[model samples]
Target: MQVTESGADLLALLRELDDPQWLEWPTSYDRSAVAARFGELVARLEGDFGVPCVAEQDTQDSSEYGRATVPAEATVCGTRIVVCVSKFGSLALVCAENPGAYLGTQDAQEEGELDDADLASVERALVELGFTVVPEELVESDYDGPSRAHLYGQRPTWWDRFFGTF
Candidate 1:
């Protein structure tokens, strides 16, 4: 009916990290479908965790005109969890208590990025909700083929390697 200690633990971990970190749902599904699941999660956050959750359209050109967008983030126990859906429907995650952006690897480890416990709790909660957590970037084989840059023999920067990757 509502979230559990695991959810609160995740919120604590998010607060402790204080820097952006990444999480991935291995399975790619339509954003509309996932948004429903997100709604359930938001309900749990408010009903069980006592956190005020918010949902809003991302307002990014990359986002769809009027569908497939949700709050994409929330803060609980003083930490924040940000959820982002790709144009192609994959879910990418980042959490922080402070204001900034992290791309999973650009920042050094000394900055208090999320620890394993933090990742585990959030990942466990997601797994219970029917999503497989991928640790990092999806392999090239996960896609249909090499990207346009690779296909055309143009070497794109490592940062530009993946499609819909932030």
Candidate 2:
């Protein structure tokens, strides 16, 4: 089946597979079923939009105090579109014009970071999402980090507004 390229269409496809009534077993115990459903969606997207879609299972093991990470599927059109599934199953799509470019590899053992193919895929996905792809130099801008002191030349109070104090 062909899927529409719009975000709304993608969201609708996700909802259909994620719906509780379509499954033969409980979702908690049916991991393969979930993967299959996602794969089907990806296939449809590829067929309809000529975009590549790939899913990676999230790692479960982590340090005791480590932050929880979402499971992600990387879709490539003109830029990289990362669709991450939160613990609660809600989805968020983040587009990076240069995927894995600035960031180093997660594995310390790995020799290098993301290569050109990775960046190309990211660029493709971003374009599929209707973003205009431009050279980094054209859009580059600098912003300083938040200031430590309050705007009135004093430290912020507990009730002080965040951005206002900065």
Candidate 3:
């Protein structure tokens, strides 16, 4: 794949995207990174990782009905998972209770509950794929860090934090 940004730069951009105050579609820098790595990521997802998934590249804003993805899916073993790959290279892997129904993979891997070994192998692959991987501990966690503070022009209620992870 054509990598447009250094991993360090990508990481910084990812941190920028992580800002609760930041909103809007990914910047060109972020999009460039995603566009460059998308192919290799999908390959690993469908190949080495044994997870069959695709990205929704048409999302123009964060509020679209199908914001998948921005990037996520595949089944690992018996568990149905959604993998969200951000434009800046941060990756989130989460468990899905419903098949083909969106589990809101947006920026909330903490809610992701997966087998430890399984998640490890996946994170390893992601690291190899040049992604800024999130910590495994963050998955299946009760993280109350700074999250998306608002959507549209209105502030979200307490239940709406981090894309309504409930």
Q: lDDT of each prediction vs. the true structure?
A: 0.35, 0.31, 0.41
3-75 in candidate 3: lDDT tens per residue? Answer: 2455456444444555464443423345555555655665665665454555545344441111121112343
CA displacement after TM-score superposition, residue 117 of candidate 1 (Å)? 4.4
Q: Cα RMSDs of all predictions?
A: 11.4, 14.8, 8.5
lDDT of 1 by residue, 1-166 (tens): 1223353353343233222222112234355675676665455445433446554433243321111111224322223544332323222333433213443411311355544444444545555665423223221123222343332234332112222333
Please, what are the lDDT tens digits per residue for candidate 2 over residues 26-57?
24434554454445545544554455655554
How does each model score on TM-score?
0.43, 0.29, 0.49
lDDT agreement of model 2 with the native: 0.31
Residue pairs clashing in model 1 are none
Displacement of residue 58 (Cα, Å) in model 1 is 7.1
- Tell me how far the alpha carbon of residue 153 in candidate 2 is from the true structure, in angstroms, after superposition: 29
Q: What is the descending TM-score order?
A: 3, 1, 2
Question: Going through the candidates in order, what is the number of backbone clashes in each?
Answer: 0, 11, 1
